[model samples]
Structures are given as C-alpha cells and as structure tokens.
Target: MLQLYGNPRSRAMRCLWMLEEVGRPYQLVEKTTHADDLQTAEYLRLNPNARIPTLVDGDLVLWESMAINLYLAQRYDGPMHCAGPEVLGLAAQWSFWAVLEIEHLLLNFLEHRALLAEFARDPSVTERNELLLKKPLGVLNDALAVRGYLAGNSFTVADLNVAGILMWGKMARMDLSAYPELTRWLDACLARPAYVRLRDQARRK
Candidate 1:
C-alpha cells in the first residue's frame, strides 16, 4: 500500500484529496510539520526538506504536494487523470502558476492577517500582498469566465492544484466579491466530495 506522510491540515491535504478522487487505498503516515517526526533520518530519506508531506510507494519516494498530486492524477485511472500531453502540460502550467504567481502572496497575506500573533501581525504586509494578489486573481477570474475548468471541460489536476493554493486566500478572508467567477469556481472546487472528505478528516483533530 502507498504511504503518505503528513497531517491532513497541511499541504498533504491536497494529496489526500487527490487520492480520494482517484479512489486509491493508502495510508496516511501523519507527520505534523515542525515536529520531530519529520526530522528523523528515516523520514529525511523520504523527504530531505523535512516537510510534512512525503509519499512512499515501493522504491519511489516523492515530496512536494503539487508534484505528488500531479503524479497521482497521471498515474492513476480517475477523473483527474490527464487525457494527453496537452492536458498534462496545462495541468503543470496552472500548478506552477499557482505556486509562483499566487501562493506566496496568499501565504504572506494569511500570515499577517490571521496566522500570526496579534503583536507579530503586520497590516502593511497583508495590505501590500493583498494588492499584489489582485492581478493574478483577476487573471484567474478572466480565465474562468470563459471556461468552467482550468485545463479541460471537466475538473482535472489543473483545477485541483490551483484551487489548493487559492484556498489560503479564503482562509485569509480576502474580499473576493469583485471576482465573481473566481469565487464561484473556488466554491465549486471546495464543495467536491473529495475535498469535503479531506476537510472532515482534517477536523478530526
């Protein structure tokens, strides 16, 4: 059986959701971030970065949440599986775009607005990144305005990966009313059964 190391609340949630979508049987190894479990030599062998998420399948070990999801989608027979090279390329494109163009901005805004202690929180940082996020959000909104999904007609890894990062924006309580299309798309993505199951599992703690 495949073993995935990470807590459901972490980026591992994305992999968990993908696994659920693929209807695969796997074990969640439950390594919480900043915990000693991730620092051990055994765990380091699987993921040198000491990250929460590391997947082990036989001799193949993979880290990075997005990469893991993309692999699962392509390797498995499921709704998220890429149909062809073009679909796979678009999936990778949106996944990378989400990480590079949007993830850091959302992270900074979330850290300042919610994750940080009151004394440590910086409204300036939150404000600046929130402004920065507008451009990409608008771009996404425009893209969604023409298509229901990012890559193809149906929901795919591209949607999953991008939505996974954008979820942090929702956590930050960023006003998204102006981007109706993006808001609708995100709402639909989060409402999927797989994502719902992931959230339910995350709430168990």
Candidate 2:
C-alpha cells in the first residue's frame, strides 16, 4: 500500500483528496509539527526540510505536495479528474498552472501575512506583498470569467489545486469580492465530495 507522511491540515490534504477521488486505499503516516518530530534524524532522512506530506511507495520516495499528486496520477492513474498529461492536455495544464501561478501568489501571502504577522515586523514589506497578490488574483479572475475550470470546462486537478490555495483567503477573511468569477469557481470546486472529505479530514486535525 502507498504511505503518505503528513498531517491532513498541511498540503498533504491535497494528496488525501486525490486518493479519495481515485478511490485508492492508502496509509496516512502522521507527522506532527512538534519540534521533536522535526528535529529527529529519522524524519530528516526522508526530507531534510522535515516538511509534512512525503510519499513512500516501496522504493519510490517523493516530496512536495504538487509533485506527489502528479506522481500519484502518473503511477496509479488515480481518477478521471487527474488523468495523465498525455491523455488530458487541459488536466495537465490546469494542474501545472495551479502550482505555477495560483500557489505562487497564495504562498507568498501566507508567508508574508500569516507567518510574518506573528512578529508584527516588516510592515512595509507586508504592504508590498499585498500589492503583489492583486495582479495574480486579477489574472485568475479574468481567466475564470471565461471558463468554469482552470484547465477546462469541467473539474480537474487544476481546479482542486488552485481552489485549495484560494480557500485560504476565506479563512483569512481577505475579501475576494472583486474576483466574482474566481469566487464562483471556488464555490463549484468546494462543492465536490472529494474536496469535502479532504476538508473534513483537515478539520479533524
């Protein structure tokens, strides 16, 4: 069986959602955020960064949430939504675009707003980061205005990956009113049963 290391609350949630969508029975190898867990030599061996959501399938080991999902799709042919690049050009496009565009902006906001907010320092840089996010959000909103999904008209990995990151804006209460199309698309993506199960798992953690 495949073994995934990471908490549901982390990026690993994406993989969990993919597994559910693919109907794959797998093991969730819980890795806590405790300092002890991260500092352990054993954990470091798997990932020097000691980040959550590492995948181990027999001899194969991989990190990075997005890469893990791609690997899962490639190896297991998970579900129609995650069809391989050759079979589904749009699916791959959206999937790759999610990490390429959407994730870049969202992660930037997360690091600058959430992580840096703790120290209350870098106020100037924070404002700059906020400004940086607007351009990407606008681009995404424009793209969504014409299409129902990021890659194509139907749900796919692109929708899941991009929506997963954008959902954070909801928790942060960062008004997305300006991006009505993006918001509408997100609503549609969140309505999926696989995403629902994935979200429920995150709440459980």
Give the top-scoring candidate (TM-score). Answer: 1
Q: Taking the tens digit of each residue's C-alpha lDDT, what string does model 2 give over 1-205?
A: 9888887767787778777766777899988877787778988888888788888888888888777766666666434444445435654565576677656656666666666557765556546656777888898899888977766667666666667777766655566888899889988877889888777767785
Which sections of candidate 2 miss by over 4 Å?
A: 81-105, 108-127
Off by over 4 Å in 1: none
Overall lDDT per candidate, in order of appearance = 0.88, 0.73
Enumerate residue pairs that collide in model 2: none
Please report, as a residue range, the 10-residue window in candidate 1 with the lowest summed lDDT. 29-38
Q: Compute the lDDT of residue 105 as modeled in candidate 2.
A: 58
RMSD of each predicted structure: 1.0, 3.0
lDDT of 2 at 173: 59
User: What TM value does model 2 have?
Assistant: 0.81
Per-prediction TM-score:
0.97, 0.81
Summing lDDT over every window of 10 consecutive residues in candidate 2, give the lowest-scoring window: 78-87
Q: lDDT by residue for model 1 over 1-205, one digit each (tens)?
A: 9889887777888888888888879999878787587889988878889986888888899998899988998888767789999999999999999989998999889899899899999899988997898999999999999999998778999999999888988988989998999999999999999999888867886
Residue 87 local lDDT, model 2: 37
